[model samples]
Target: MAKNTVIGFLGSTLDASKRDSSRWQKWRPTIGLCMQQDLRVDRLILLHGEKHESLARFITQDIASVSPETSVEPHRINFDDAWDFEEVYTELLDFAQGFPFDPEHEDYLVHITTGTHVAQICLFLLTEARFIPGKLLQTQPRRGQPDPSGSWNAIDLDLSRYDSIAQRFAASSRESTSFLKGGIETRNAAFNTIIDEIEQVATRSSAPLLLMGPTGAGKSLLARRIYELKAEKHQLSGPFVEVNCATLKGDNAMSALFGHRKGAFTGAVADRAGLLRSADGGMLFLDEIGELGLDEQAMILRAIEEKRFLPMGSDKEASSKFQLIAGTNLNLIDAVASGAFRDDLFARLNLWTFHLPGLADRKEDIEPNIDYELERYAAAEDTRVTFNKEARERYLAFATGPNAIWSGNFRDLSASITRMATLSPDGRIDRKTVDMEVARLQRLWTSDRGDDDDTQLSAILGAERLTRIDPFDRAQLSEVVKVCRHSASLSAAGRDLFAVSRQSRSSTNDADRLRKYLMKFGLSFDEVRAR
Candidate 1:
């Protein structure tokens, strides 16, 4: 087969004075560079802001004047007119679909102007929709004064890194739902831990595995990462199939998983291989497993247990040895108790359950995650952007502060970082940007925390106060708690908490403080030790 490539260009518009013209000049050259590197530039879709039609015409004319060989088409959709995310994404997806690329032969190049939130979201959705391969190019203004001649300013970008960026975005988006705020830090541990476990299970587990976690804890990422890891580790020879249980309600769930023959149902026009069959000898990830109907759950249970399932209207049983990874946020034990989920099925799944800790639980990871996000955004913008030290400190403080209970976890973080990165000038994020985000988060937290009564509020406040005390006192209390919990003797507790090998004057004072503090809190030394 001949090596053919398709290039896609998506940007707001060149006419917008707010956009750096020097940055805009980089597009054609970047495309030209890619072409020189053996990448064929086929379709260019120009996404515009307000005054889309005129801007599109101007850009098209500009490209024609510069390079008569290149054909650029304007996808005339005004982002300003977009009332909702769905509308913007849909328009972008439709335009992207129009790119004339033979998927069988050509690789795609997707270029965006400065990682805008709309652009980022559209890119993520496009990947999820599977319209085009996940790829992106970021163009930035080149340093130095413009040439005295009418030549366009220079811009630098790396074309080859698109695929890698897309993969990272896909992985992050998959794990977005699992974290309070989606970003490199929040998803890192969850992604790494899940990938490790999935690999182990794929190679070692005989029975089907169940992934249990709260909503947005990244079950889907885990599932996909598992598939990739397993494919590499076990040399699996089949495709990874994913089915969202929430989308496949009623009898459609059965047909989607276990394909039906022609005339099996109202829409069954032809025979099709079910996801299970397609995933044979590979992996099938069932997302939102709790949403499946009882009958569907029964069918899934049988398939998992017997490795065989009959399609609707077909008596013949189809055999599939696909590894099952079912994901759900529901309390499966409660579901079983309530008879919503089968006890036997729950038992089978419980054996391999892995709970993902929410973002609030991993406070230490927030700063590192933010740093990672800034770097990603900077790279995508083709700029050397860094967070102001004050902004970084403020963000870390907010993340670890009482206000951070990001229910959406990593997804929220991803959105926030993307916004900050796009809006910041030359990628210099400031405290105001951080303040806006913090205020938004605080409002959300306030609304949620309002559900709790005074008693709960007081208890939480007390805990927060304790956490803010001096490091020495905190360390002493922690040591006392640890010794009390593990050591069998009082001498051990005194020695460990006070760092004294034997009881002494200084040790007694330390013990007294510990005792007094415990009493102040209406607890005995034993209770304080118990922690």
Candidate 2:
């Protein structure tokens, strides 16, 4: 038994034609809507121009006389031209925003048959978007009969209630998710889910985003892809400006990010628009944002909240409304506890955080990523490169293996493909090239390990036993010892240290292998732990 409310424009021609008592016989859309069978309009909100004030009052009285229980309320919303889409839409939008609509206690209907075509379309859009929270009411006069009260139909615009349209939207959403992932058709369920969520958030919000991951883990690439997607949708009108916060420092950092007036400092020869201003109306990506100094952190927080900041040596404040996407490998919670990061800024950026896992964590995805990297190399070099069947299988086996640490994530894979393609003979990578690449990768990963520096082993080895060992043995043993110290037990330490080599063995005995390996140096797991 909720009351029904109708909102519409006053029909100047139809509603104004009535002056005498017999004028009620003429068909009018507004009056006709309230007179429909079994329809009780408890309230009517009418929109009219200033010139149509008298006409609007006359119709209100006529409707009151015909339907005593119904209350007619007239609202004046005037614009210069009836056909001005911008003006009409803006006026209607303002009305819809300011009006105290009670949709819970009353059902609402927007009468679309009375306004101009532009106004009608705007009202339809508003109702469809739920800005007005109503269904559409379209009325027309009866054709054969001299029916004064026209027939009316209420149209529902909720798209989700329609399966065909919902399916189309679902397909488009999948495409957007794939686009965000660079169209690689990645198979990792976790990464794919993250991409899908990122697409949804990016499309609906302009809030700050936090991307936490290790260096070279595709943070910069992902940020750029997001910017491109938003630009395609016309969400951003300005340029995408990226800055490496790790490289910014001291007074120069302030000047570079917030700009400065002429004679602001010694190097201020001209007025400069900083990175924030350059990104106005678009996005600003701050990579390694944890590296920013405390002073700069304070400034960034103010600018993000207020869209205004005082530049270096300037009295006037500058304004730049930009979306922020912050990237960091550092654990900002630890930084905040250590007094190196601001908790307030962290709270703001932490609202939408996405952690991108390293390439080592998602081995199943390595095959597809390898194919993607090879395609990238071919495109960049203007020459196609393909691996022989045997070589392809060999490379794929090693890549998906535990030994492929991928310390630099996608960056390492990309560079490895670039090297092999460049070194390939006649655009064909064979077994020989694969073998050479495998050996090179082993050396490279060993050198990039946790304890590549041999000197660190001297404390336990007494500087005498260390000299007797080769650099290769020293690097391997150092990494093993470091892992042991961090691990809770001998077996757990062995699992981590032997994660790569255990795959090749016929039988897995990580603890036994580690114990025997330590025995070669006249040491025990207990002895290593004592250090």
Candidate 3:
């Protein structure tokens, strides 16, 4: 490699001082560059404007006189406005690209001090983007300091130390959270806090993390995201292994989780390496962990605590150093009370437990998630699909409405988008498509609703009040109950549920009317809200 050259725009007018013979006494930056013995500017490309052509010649002569070894070349450029960022940028870019460049024998530097702020920024961009392969040189004024020739420093275009880059990193973190949630920026603060903590723990620690949530509430998805995050950080080296404990039963459970030797079971023909062995040096996600039998749970507890387990029909114990992330909808405490789950195993896995909320609890995030689902559908199908303004509004209204149970959480949202995207003609979803999808979702949710909810509701409101209201009224009021449970107050629930009715009422006592309606069923707003 050869020496680096300084390529700068000439501040011809600024550097032309008639009062000084020494030239160094004037403290002009281009003159100051000649004073630095450490930086060898073998060649200097002086870019000048049309008006400064004569001044450019004088400065070039002055530079040559001061430093006989340094070669200076003056080039004139016509600019409509030096102050205009676009004009300055375009002109400088053209000049930088058209220059006779030799990277193997020479390096370069862009003098940022000689031009207007616009020109300075343009030079910085070109250098930073590698359009001009060099660093930036900034010259500072002496301002009555001892050094008359003013100081000079070189600035690398690396922005890693800047606050703006940190802000971008934070934005990427927010994006990662959205990715884990299937593109939903969940508005639930508790859920967001959990995500933050999980991110920290996933990156910093390998302790077992237990995710507890209702089925379809994204436990499995979150577990997978934790694996991905850890993998990205190079915290885990092996592939992620996932298994649903609910599907394992009897001898099959032991064989699937702990491996089995040949002739260990009726159909065993070869030695098997189970999920635990497969997850060595990585993560094992056990979904529905409460369904594991007692015998399997004991062996799993040993594997988690000791990183060692015995293969079935073999006396030798195999060791697999792996991390555990268990997910379950079951309340393990209740399971312990019923002797269904091992107490010691639950304790080991309970060190870090996160409860994920159902879709209904994060209604505010539905709109953004709708757009995300559309984008996801487009990517998967390799076809663009967009919902019209009115159609989007209609779908959002129904989705966030009390009638939308969202029993399947993100799974349901994805399915809904898939259906609408498929049915949409020409990749555009209209009002008709929205209505059909809404009706289909309603039917699916209605069919999915079992008597368990009605039984719970009956227990909460008492059978006496339930019998007084007809089943039709009961169904209508159940929706009202859901709204009230989610609302901040009775007034808010009334405002949402009775928006049209409140408009018609001469006396705007929406909360009072809502109170009276609940009172007829022997229920109070506070009781329903608490539920």
Sliding window of 10 residues with minimal summed lDDT for model 3: 462-471
The sequence of per-residue lDDT tens digits that candidate 1 reaches over residues 82-118 is 5467777777777667866565765455554423566
Model 3 Cα shift for residue 5 (angstroms) = 45
Q: Best by TM-score, which number?
A: 2
Superposition error at 508 for model 3 (Å): 30
Over 69-98, each residue of candidate 2 has an lDDT whose tens digit, in order, gives 889999998889989998888888899999
Give stretches of model 2 more than 4 Å off.
1-13, 19-27, 34-108, 115-133, 140-153, 450-531
Best by lDDT: 2
Clashing pairs in 3: none
RMSD in order of candidates: 22.1, 9.2, 18.5
Query: Tens digits of per-residue lDDT for model 3 on 263-328?
Result: 998998999998899999999999999999999999999999899999999889999999999999
Worst 10 residues of 2 by lDDT: 450-459
TM-score-based ranking, best first?
A: 2, 3, 1
Clashing pairs in 2: none
